[model samples]
Target: MSGAVWDAGRCWRCEADDVPVIWLGPVQTQEHGAGPFAACEPCIRRLEQLVETHHMQADRSA
Candidate 1:
């Protein structure tokens, strides 16, 4: 699906342009469920931060 074009106007987290939306595919886990939504650059960053926090918490617990 590389080089696929996404609908820029549907993106909510960032200004829609030529940039591809992040996390606009199926969810990685069953708990999260499936997703076809689009996210912008800042949202992607926020998601990364959230994942990092979760990982850190997991490590601390371990």
Candidate 2:
């Protein structure tokens, strides 16, 4: 979807209508265009922390 469409509603995570503080960094690619799915600041930070934690866990297991 286009950036306008992607950002047209509340954050996909927290469902807030505030101005964008950050994004999920393009986890999906639209067939017609490209845009990073947006998320609230708390959601973004939580997602990043989860990713880092998972990576660390994977490294430890490896």
- lDDT against true structure, model 1: 0.65
Encode model 2's per-residue lDDT on 7-36: one tens digit a residue.
Answer: 444576777886554555565555756665
Top-lDDT candidate index: 2
Error of 2 at 50 (Å): 0.5
lDDT of 2 at 22: 54
RMSD of each: 5.8, 7.1
The most accurate candidate by TM-score is: 2
Per-residue lDDT value at 14 in model 1: 56
Q: Which stretches of model 1 miss by more than 4 angstroms?
A: 1-9, 12-19, 27-33
